[model samples]
Target: MKIYSFRKEEGKKITKYDSNFIMSRIIQSEKPVHVGCMHLEKNGVIGYHQAVVPQLLLIMNGEGLVRGERDEYIKVQSGDAVFWEKDEWHETKTDLGLTAIVIESEELNPDSFMALRIN
Candidate 1:
């Protein structure tokens, strides 16, 4: 298993379309861009976007909400992990600030299902 640690040194400030956010890359590969943890400043918001593969967003600290199609909004906090599917419309809003760990993989490990294969 590959281990990734998110420390302060790896933190980086990112801005897109006037939104200021911070991200730390604990693990990343050209096949799958993996971001371990990201800290969003107060009042920060990431615009609607989609991922190439499935992603898991685990909130480690602070609070936020995720908005999706049809005005769907889900409140998220520490210990809350939100799974975002590929090509889905979504956006994140930091209301009470935010800190989260984003985990993703390029391809699904086929070996994981060996024991359950009926064929």
Candidate 2:
């Protein structure tokens, strides 16, 4: 059995066109399997990027838009959770600012949650 712990720390201020803050707290991780919480500040964009591994995003607060490859987009609000596959390109845009907890794991259960990906 593996046990992981999350410790709170000062988040890094991320600026790529919008004011935002990000805190990466590792939940459980071992090589290909990684889980963590991503805390985002209001009106912040995570910028377009690709997921190296399968991941899940659970909206903790606020509203936002997720843009995937080929302009694929999805709207996410409070209590919304999204799943992203590996090697997929994606980005996040917050409408009214947001805070989301991200979980990346290889042991993803398809029937248990929303599986989202970009072609």
Q: Could you say which candidate leads in lDDT?
A: 2
Deviation (Å) of 73 in candidate 1: 0.9
Candidate 1 residue lDDT tens string, 34-91? 6677889999887888756766566689888876554767677764556556666778
Q: Could you give me the TM-score of model 2 versus the true structure?
A: 0.61
Worst 10 residues of 1 by lDDT: 110-119
lDDT of 1 at 88: 62
For each candidate, the alpha-carbon lDDT, in order, equals 0.60, 0.61
lDDT of 1: 0.60
Instruction: Name the best candidate (by TM-score).
Output: 2
Q: In model 1, what are the clashing residue pairs, if there are any?
A: none
